[model samples]
Target: MVFRFAKTLDPITLFHAPSLQTSTNALNILKAASAAATAGTVTSNRGEFQLEITTAPPTTDQLRNIIDYVTANPAGAGSNKTDYAVGEVIKGAKDAEDAVKRFKEGGEGTFIRPITVDWTNGKAVLGDNESEILKMVHQLEAN
Candidate 1:
C-alpha cells in the first residue's frame, strides 16, 4: 500500500494600505486567523494556508482578477452599490473598463483597501468586517 498527502497551496492575500485604519484592522484580523490556523485552533476544509500581506496595490492583472472574483461573489460587495461591484474594489470604477481607466489615472491611490482574497476558493471580502473576513478565511474550498 502507498500513502500520499497532497500539498495544500491555498494562499489568502490581503491588499492592505497602511494609512487606512480599516486596512490596518483587517491586517490584524488576518494575522490572528493565520496564527489560529497555524496553531490548529482554526479549522477549515482547506486546512493550512499562507497569508500574503502586501501594502502595494495589486498589479493590473491582479486588479482585474480581484474585480472578477468579487463580482462573482457578491457578498464581497457588502452594503455598497451592488450594481457596480467594481466600485466596491476600485473607488470610482463604474465597471470593469472604468476600473482599468480609473486605476491607470490614479494608480494605487484609487484602490479601496483592506480586500482579502482566497484565490483558490474564488472568494474575496472587501472591507474590514471581521465576521465577513473570517468567514471567507475559514470557508470550505469548493470541489
Candidate 2:
C-alpha cells in the first residue's frame, strides 16, 4: 500500500524489518527512521510504519521492536504490524541436534517438509553422481 504523507492526519516515519535469518542489516526504511529520530522525542514523532513481507521470516527482536513501535506510536487507530511476524527461530542452540530439539519443542510454525530430497533441477537435470552423493548424505541424516 502506497501511503500519502499529506493526506494522513499526522506526519509519519517508516522502518525496515528483519529479513528472516538470511540478513541482519537495516534497509532503506530503517535508515530513514534513523535520520528522523536522530535527535528528538520518540513519542512526539508523528508516526512509524514497519516494512514487512509475508514470505520472508521475521526475527524475534524485529517482532518485539515492531510491536513496541506499534503500541507506542498509534497508526491512526489500527492493529499495526500484527501480521508482520511469521517466523519461528531455533534459538539458544548451537548444534543441529540441539536446534532440532528446541525447534520441535518450541518452534512456532509446523514446517511441512517433503518426504525426500529431490536432486533433479526440474526435468532439465536427471540423476548423476552428484545426485547419488546427495542422496547418500540425505539418507545418512535420519528424519
lDDT digits (tens) for residues 1-143 of candidate 2: 99866542212221212433222222332334434444432332233332232333224443333233322234554432222111222345443345445546665442211111112111110112233222222222212
Off by over 4 Å in 1: 1-6, 72-84, 140-143
- TM-scores, each model vs. reference: 0.82, 0.21
Q: Which pairs of residues clash in candidate 1, taking residues 3 or more apart in a chain or in different chains?
A: none
Candidate 1 residue lDDT tens string, 39-140: 888777656688999988899888887887777445654432112278888887888989988998999889888889888866788888888777778773
TM accuracy, model 2: 0.21
Q: Where's the lowest-lDDT run of ten residues in candidate 1?
A: 75-84
Model 2 residue pairs with clashes: 16-30
State the local distance difference test value for candidate 1.
0.80
The global Cα lDDT (0 to 1) of model 2 is 0.29
lDDT of each: 0.80, 0.29
lDDT accuracy of residue 107 in candidate 1: 91
